[model samples]
Target: MKYNNFRKAVSSLTSQRSDSSLPVVALLTGLAVGAVIGVLFAPERGADIRTKISDKAKDLSDAAKDKLQAVKNKFHSEGHELADLKDEVVDKVKSKARAAEELKDEVIEDAKSKAKDLADDVKAAANEVKNS
Candidate 1:
């Protein structure tokens, strides 16, 4: 049987070497050679096979291109959305900054008013003490 012959061949070759990989490599090489021989001996015309392979390869390439374009479009749309979000965030920060500046001015004015009132009260107290 072919299996028995294959096993015998592998055993014979492995007897010559200690490495386990020798048998595996020989098996793979035998399979590759057999496949090449089979494909060469097949009844189909070589030209027809080549044409079919070319057409299928082209179809696969076009499909891949379409997928790539779709991804590009999605990324572009997401980039625009991100830009809009960035602008929104910047506007909000500017508004907050303006509000903080206005609050600072108001606090400074209030502190000045309070200081003037305290000074006036101190002057009035000193005048009263002098009169007494």
Candidate 2:
């Protein structure tokens, strides 16, 4: 039950993280489109316009690279967090399994002890009947 809840929570967080990145993608797309349109309509000499457009393209490219790096770093961080959570959950499960095994062993031993006691009582009763 606890594990299921943890899984659900992690899934929710992961989904939210993915959803948040969509807006960044859309913003980048819009910026690129706007740059292209602005470059096409500028009233400068052809060579000058080309140079300006090229510079603008380089700037946009750098901005994109920076944003991409940021996203990558965030993804890496989240991945590590997920791995740590996985390890924690695994440890919790292992401990729970170990506890369950110990309880099972105790229960089996208790049952065996009870059975032995019952057998001894029956034997004592049988001896009493024989000696009567």
Candidate 3:
């Protein structure tokens, strides 16, 4: 039961789409709103304040773009890593299955040989009793 659940969890993790960037975007938006509000309330000349606000907005835009790009890069890297992990898992399972098959064959052959030996022993005893 636990193993089935574990397999389900692993498969779900691999299949589910990660929306991890949503939180990052939301945090950046909150920061932008706070910064704008702080800038608006500051006592300063209107023109200078406007310039500062514009610069800050531009800076925030650039930062957001950089972060989004970084997130995309990391997502792609992790996808590759997952693919490699899946391949490794498949290879390991195949190897284990092959090993099990070989073991089964060995056990079957050993049982057959033992059965033959037992049969020969029985036949010899029967012949000895008949002769006596």
Candidate 4:
């Protein structure tokens, strides 16, 4: 149950994060593109340009890691909420199933009682006819 809830929470978070992150992602992409263009056009030595590119790459990587960790923590917290919801649903289903089973048993017993009474009435009528 815990595992299922956690999975569902993670899936839900993934979808939501993707939707909300679109603008951030686009902004980061634009910044990276612009940085690269500026670097290429600058009249710097080849070695200096390479060093700047490496530094930019490391910065982007670190930022991505931070965002990922934050998302992971948020989903982990929400997993408990999902698990509670799942438990409530399972309990309601079990209660309904028990009620249905009880109703079925009552119906069967009532039918049996009625059938026995009917048989007794028929036998009494036949005995009267025999005596007459």
The local distance difference test score of each candidate is 0.89, 0.87, 0.85, 0.86
Question: What is the Å distance of residue 93 in model 3 from its true position?
Answer: 1.1
- Residue 26, candidate 3: C-alpha displacement in angstroms: 18
Query: What is the TM-score of candidate 4?
Result: 0.51
Task: Identify the leading candidate in terms of lDDT.
Answer: 1
The TM-score values for the models, in the order shown, are 0.67, 0.66, 0.63, 0.51
Model 3 Cα lDDT, one tens digit per residue, 12-97: 65456357755655566568768777778978878998898799999999999999999999999999999999999999999999
Which pairs in model 3 have colliding backbones? none
Q: Where does model 3 exceed 4 Å of error?
A: 1-45
lDDT rank order: 1, 2, 4, 3
Task: List the candidate numbers ranked by TM-score, top first.
Answer: 1, 2, 3, 4
Model 4, 18-86: lDDT tens per residue?
678867755765686688778779899979988987999999999999999999999998998899999
Clashes counted in candidate 1 amount to 0
Residue-wise lDDT of candidate 1 within 13-130, one digit each (tens)? 7777779679687878689778678769978898886788699999999999999999999999999999999999999999999999999999999999999999999999999999
Pitting candidate 2 against candidate 4, the one with the higher TM-score is: 2
For residue 88, give model 2's deviation from the true position in Å. Answer: 0.5
Evaluated against the true structure, the overall lDDT of model 2 is 0.87
Whose lDDT is higher: candidate 1's or candidate 2's? 1
